[model samples]
Structures are given as C-alpha cells and as structure tokens.
Target: MTSETALPTPASPLDLGETLTFERDGAIGILTLDRAAKRNALDDATITRLGEFFAAVPEGIRAVVLTTAGEHFCAGLDLSEMTDRDAVSGLHHSRRWHATMNAIAESAIPVIAVLQGAVIGGGLELASAAHLRVAEDSAYFALPEGKRGLFVGGGASVRVPRLIGLTRVQDMMLTGRSFDAVDAETIGLVNYRVPAGAGTAKARELAAAIASNSEVTNYAITQALPRIVESGRDEGYMMESLMAAVAQSSTEAKALMRDFLDGTGPKVRK
Candidate 1:
C-alpha cells in the first residue's frame, strides 16, 4: 500500500519546519522533537508537523519511534503562545491538540515513545497516544497545569487515565507530583524502563520486533485491540473473532503459517 503523501527517506529527510525532524532506519521511522531549547515543548507548529507525519506513514515503514533530542522528552505546551488567546480561541487551540494527538493514536503503524527527563502536562498526554512507551531512568512525569491555574487542554484527561488510572492522574494534576521512570512503569505509564541513555536502543529493538510481524497482524493488534478492550463482553468477543478471521485471511499470514508448519519459522522464546 503506497502512501498518498510522500514521506522522508533516509537519503532525504523532510524539512518539517524548525520543531520536528524525520529519519529512516530500515523499516522503522524515527521522528524527533527538535525544539530542545524549550525542552521540546509542544506548540502550534510542532503539532502541525506531527500531524503531517502520523497521518500518513508510508508503506515499508512498519513502525515509528517518537523521541526527542537533548535531555527532556517534552516540557508540555509553550505557555507564551497560550497567554495571547481568549476563551473561544483557547478552546479551538486545545481541540487542535486533540486532533493531532488522535492522528498519532489512530495511525496504522504502531508508535513507540522514548521518554526521558520531563514528561509533563501536554508532554505526558502526547506520550500516552503512542502504542508503547519506553522510559529512561532520567525520565519523570507530572501534570502541573493545576498549579499554573490551567487545566489539561490535550487528551490527557482521556488517554492518561486509561494508562495510569483516574486516581493517579488526579493526584498528579492536583498536587503537581512527579513520578520517576521506575514509578512510571509500576503505575502502567510506561511499558519498559532502561538506564538513562538506553531508552533509544531499547525502543529501537522493540520497534524492530514489531516491524517483523505480519503487517496484517500488527494492524489488527494496533487498531482492533483497543476498540475490543473498550467494548462490552459479548461485543468484544465478536470483534475479536472478526479481527482474528480477517488477520488470518491475509496472504502474508497464510505464508507465515506455512513456514511455521514446515519448521522454518522462528520458535517462541523460552
């Protein structure tokens, strides 16, 4: 399946303005948040660039690693931009964040977020949209909007709760409490934790494994699994069966099964 929009290749990276950059490594795409001076803060331009990348992950790109340059993953939204907007404009601005975040969450390919340093407010919301999160020991999370007399305008109110639970989210927002990488893993905010500088390697390793799976199976897992989980018991089972059938019916799936039966495929890890 070809992408309608042209994507950046390893030989030629796309110029996504000043805040975002893309690089290719085999089947995995690495999208870096480049505004490190602001601790990689999310702004209007950054969100638009992110939306462009996530909205159309071209064929051959099986997975993506959403990471940042420098110490912090992200510090949250740029407050300087917020000071000029009124209530109606603020509402529209927040919805733009929701739309960009939704594009990431609903992408066809799975995204692995590499977290380090500050993952606060909108930053935490952004990471929650990814399929998997790998946090470095230096990573920390918080929602300090309440302290600033502001509320979360991103999808944090929805996605963050689904990850760590409503109670923990409330606590963070209310008290401006921060959780380290270890605590993040314990609270279900991150899937894996590694040493301070090991996050990128770990995320790449997982992305490679995911990229090796049949695209059909990966699509089913990334797309259908969430919906099924949110569905009622009987409805969930029905959706699961349908997804299973659809995944198995793919030609690639049939070939993979044939290889497995012939003892040529890799065995399950012990």
Candidate 2:
C-alpha cells in the first residue's frame, strides 16, 4: 500500500441522499455505497445519484474516498433493471453510464476507490473511473458482460483499457476471467493492495495526502496532465511548461519552496 499518515474519524456526515452516505474529514470526503442488501449493485437511481453527488462534490472536500458497505464493493449495474428495453433505449442507457463515469473522472478533486469482493462488470468500470484504487485481499475483479451476452456499457471500454491495457481487458471480457487483488495490482488495475477490510483506511490515508496538495497542483494533475499525455510530443512539452510556470507562480508554491529551502518542510527519504 502507498505510504500515508493516519487520521481520526470524520466530524460529521453530510446529507448526500439515499443509496449512499457522505462524510467529511478535514479536506477529505468519504462517499460510501450504502446498499449492502444488493451488494451495492447500482440501479438507475443509484448510478444517477453517484454521478450527481460527485459532479458537485462539496467545496470543503478536496479529495474523496469511495467505499461501500458489506463484503462486496459492487456487483455492477443492477441487472434486474435490464428488463424491457429496446436497442435505442439500451444505447441511451449506456450513454448515461458513460456520462456518470466521466463525471467522476473529470472532477478536479482526486477520487480513490476502496475495493473489496466482487468488483465485476460495471463495478470494475466504476473503479476505473477513480484516480486511484486501493484493493483489499478479498477483492476480485472481472468483466462478465460476455457471459451475460452484453458488452460493457460504462466507460470501462475506454478507461479500463487505459489502466490495464486493451489486450488484458479483451482477455478478461472474452473469457469472463477473474483477477484477485494481487493480480489486479500487478496488472495496474489497483494502485495499492492491502489485507482484507483495510482498503477504506488506506484509501482515506491517500486522500488525506492528496488533500494536502496545492489546489493548482491537484487541478493540473486532474485536468491538464491527462490531456497533455494525449497530445503530440511538442504540444505536450509546451503544455507542461505552461503548467509549470502557473504552478510556480502560485503563492502556495512560493511558501512551500521557501519552507523546503529553509529546511522546514519534509525532505525526500526512503
């Protein structure tokens, strides 16, 4: 797991509405899937709620820790909602999922998914949307859409591939293959792997560190960096230099630099 400092419980929970709960601990927000009965499977209401909530993440929350109740993190979309939909409706549904996933990924604040058992189908897509993922030993990932005679609707087709690569995603989808936490980590699906039930704590720790970052730095990473990667080499370098100038010009940057130069700030250490 990534190194992080521990924090106490949040002061109070925020009212983010049903199917989920929200709490703020300093600059970090804890967004939890509260649907244990369905193993946190996301129906339309839940998915819409998830998107809406994150799209307007509280100003006080600079980073997020996404977790769920029960053993399983999410079983994917509530397949029960698959009843009676024409091809056009299905297309719209898929697009809706795409929008939901995109909202999370596009947020300026970093999101960290705390993954546990049964991270499958749309569950995997949801995890992929996170900037970082912490997987517990009990966590297992899969793409069972093939067996269900359906293709992935969420942005997994695009985002997951970027993380674990297209070939591996193809292999998993084609064979309905499942990967454990360690394997997921090795494949780049998860940033950190921890013992069972330790995912949330570790993820929150990461969130705390992320929250401590300068606002401009975090915004650049969440916004400019990904776009820069997709640009041509010359364009990417130009973008990087522009961002570097803006970042260094910040008052926060000046203060931090002074601290480092004066030996007040923490130094790099193994």
Candidate 3:
C-alpha cells in the first residue's frame, strides 16, 4: 500500500465538489455522499461525479467503501431535479444513469456500501450497484417509483433483481413495500448487517480484508465470477477454467501459494 504522500495521481481530476467527498485510508478509497439536506439524494451532478470517481480511481487503491453523511444513506433521486421530457429525452436520461451504475458495478476493485436509514427508489438502485453491502440495523429499503407512477430509471430492474430475485423486486416495485435490514439480508440484498452506528466500521473491516487479497485473484473474483455465472454452463465452465489458469499464473499468486506451502501464509479462520 502506498502512503498518502506517495499516492499516484488520479487518472482524472476528482473535483466532485461538496456533494461527494473522496479520501483514502491506506489502500481503501472512501466515498461519502454528503447531501444530507436532501437525504443524500442523487442529482445529475452527483451521479456524474460518481461515474468520474470510479472511472479514474487512483492507482493502488484495492477497494472502496461508499457511505453517506447523516442518518440516511440515501432517500433516492432529488425529486426537484425531475423535469418533463419526451420519450427520446427520457430514454437518454435513463441511459446516463445506467452508465453510472454500470461503472460502479463493473469497477475493477470491489465496492462496499454502508447502508443506513432510508434506501429508497434510486437509493436502492445505487446500493444494488455495489459489489457488497453492509446494512445498518436502521436501514430500510424500498422502490417507491412505482407508487409515483414511474418505473426505475437506474439499473435496478436488472441489478436489483439479480441480487434478490425478480419476484422480490417485482413485489417491492408493485406494492411500494419496504424491507428492513434483516429481511434484506435474508433475501441476499446485503452481504452484512450491523448496529446502526457500526456500519462504516464493519464496511472498513471488509474493505481491508478485500484489500489484502492478491490483485489477480481479486480481479477474477470481481470481474470473471459474475460473467461466468451469467454464461451458459459449458461457457461458464470454460471461462472459469481460463480465469483459474490466468489467476494462478500471476507472480503474486505463486508467491502466496509458496507461502502457504511453507507455513508462512495466513490460514482461514472463523
């Protein structure tokens, strides 16, 4: 891990302004949504900044923890940003959101979201984009777009369904139902759940653990695993085999294996 003074410059300038705050804790990059006045509601600028941040994550950052200020992680999109538009314009707008969410979901390093309070509508969609989520006990998720006579504009229709299943997402959208953190964990919406104030700590712990992994293995787990799972069985097997071979070929992987055999590597523990 590089020291803060020695960190590489970002690929793009991270002048995301006050709505988003970016910092580094060793190898872990932390991004916090800071629009508490709007319950950290996302707007065009915020979403665009998110895309930029992920697109140009500083070199050597192995993982990210996405959290927010105030009580709520997010209450969804800023309704004030809503504008009437024709079908063509609306389609383009939605596509922009899809692109941003895709950037998060497909980032090279893992992203862990710390969820608390309301995770509604676009907020739920946003959390779904993270590779892993740690929800506070106070967290509650909902898709209220349906109640507002609108469907999800983000990648929720695809990503959320993939996490929790089509039926569950369908139910949430159709009825504007809200699920608490426990229920969310039960349905696999979140990977971890903790006390309200402990979310960030837990997420940091997870990010640290993720940062300790070999980059090649992490890449295979984050990048190849999802595609392999989505592929046809034969194709999936082939992809997995290829990824396995590639990962094992890395010098870091070989060194780690040598350490394991030499009794110098960390062992799996509960």
Candidate 4:
C-alpha cells in the first residue's frame, strides 16, 4: 500500500489550528501528534484536533496507527491550561479527554500505538487505549501526576491499571519511577519492543497483517476479547463459544477452510 494517501486536514469551525496530522496508508489510518516543539504535549487545541481526526476517520480505513513526529511521543497534557480550574470545570476538562481517547479505543477499526522517547502522564493514557502497543528502544514510560500535585485526568486510572498492576502504576506516580521499553514490555504495558526508529514501520506491518483478516473475524476479535476478559469464566466461556460459532459459520471462514483443505492456502512456514 502506498504511504502517501491524502487524508482530510483538521478543519473545525472553532479553528483551534492543526496540532495533529492525519494521513492514510492504504487501509491504515495514521494519526500523528505534531506538537514537537512542546514534546507533543497535548493542549486544548491538540486535543480538539485529536477528537476531530478520530471522529471523522474515513470509512474505508481498516486499522489505525497512532504515533508522533518528534523525539518524544508525548510528554503529557499541557499543564499551562490547567491553572485556576475549579472542580466542575476540572471534571468537564477531564471528561473531554475521556471522550477523545474513547473515540480512538472504540473506533470501528483497531488501533496500534507506536511509541518512542518519553511517553508520560496523559501520553501513556493515550497509548493504553490502543489495542496493541509497539515501543522503540528509546521509549520510556512514566506517571508524574503525583509530582505535579494532580491526579490522572485521563483514563489512565482505569486503562493503565489493566496493563500494569495497580501497584506498579502507583509506584510510578508516587516515586516518579520510569520504565524503559523492555521493562514496559515485561510489565505488559507494551506488546513489542524494537530498535529505535523502527516503531512506526513495525506498527504498520502489524496493522497490515491484521487488515488481511476477514472483516467479521477482526471485528469480533477487537470487540469481544476485552469483554470476555472482564467477564466471569462461565459467562466468558458462553460468550466465547457464541462468538466462535458465529465466526466459523461465516462465508469467509468456510472459504478459508476449503482453501486449506484443497491445498490452495499458503503452507505454514517458520
């Protein structure tokens, strides 16, 4: 797939200016944080652009890769915008982030995050929303909300805990501890760790492989796996069985099975 497909530029009536870049690589949608001067720190405008980009993702897209064009993936939210905010205002502000991030998480296509350099605070929260995460050697993860006398305003308090243990997250916040890519992978924060500068390519390759799957299978995998994990074993098994029956009964699945039996499908190779 060509990597130069044009995507809609961020254009809002409010005109917050473009702090994000959206592009399409064949069936893969690419969203890049463009605020390099601030280490891609998400300000109100950036957040708005992010919401707009994800909300309007093209229907033809099959998957998405979230990355940034900078040494740092993201340093977190712009605290400059947080000054003098009252309780009601703070809750709404945080809710805005939740809405934006949830759009990414709940998109029709799965999202893969490509991380490098500093991924801290709200940055980590964003990455956690993706279905898969690939971190480069240069990437580091941290949660410094405690040091800033603030709590996690993004969905980190919920999503991140599902990745790494609550204790590890608390330690990162409480003691300002940082974890490198390898450690992050070990702790389940990232699915893969590759050499620096290779994260986006790797993520694209992964997304491409995922895009080749049957649409129904991909949809079920993305939508049902998380719910199954959250359910009790008995209920989860019932749901899994139901999904399995539905998936295998698809015409695509039957065609694939016929190809395999007819020796038309590619043989397994190491």
Estimated TM-score for each candidate: 0.93, 0.93, 0.94, 0.89
Q: Candidate 3 residues 1-270, lDDT tens each? A: 212112223356577766988889999999999999889999988887887788677788999999999999999988877767778767766777887787788889899999999999889989999999999999999999988989899888998988989999999999889999999999999999999799999999999999988899998988899999899999999999999999999999999999999999999899
Best by TM-score: 3
lDDT of 1 by residue, 141-244 (tens): 99999999999988999999999889999999899899999999998999999999999999999999999888999999989999999999999999999999
lDDT of 1: 0.88
**What is the TM-score (0 to 1) of candidate 2?**
0.93
Candidate 2, residues 1-270, lDDT tens digits: the string is 111111112233243458888878999988999889998898987777777776778887899999999999999999898878889788878877877787789898899999999999999999999999999999999999999899999888899889989999999999989999999999899999999978888998899888877888998999999999899999999999999999999988888899999999868889
- What is the Cα-based lDDT of residue 204 in candidate 4? 96
Query: How accurate locally, in lDDT, is each candidate?
Result: 0.88, 0.86, 0.88, 0.84
Q: Which pairs clash in model 1?
A: none
TM-score of 3: 0.94
Which prediction has more favorable lDDT, 1 or 2?
1
State the lDDT of candidate 4 residue by residue for 174-232, as single tens digits.
Answer: 99999999899998999999999999999999999887666778878878888899999
The count of backbone overlaps in candidate 2 is 0
- Candidate 2 segments exceeding 4 Å error: 1-15
Worst lDDT window (10 residues) for model 4?
Answer: 1-10
RMSD of each: 4.2, 7.0, 5.6, 5.9
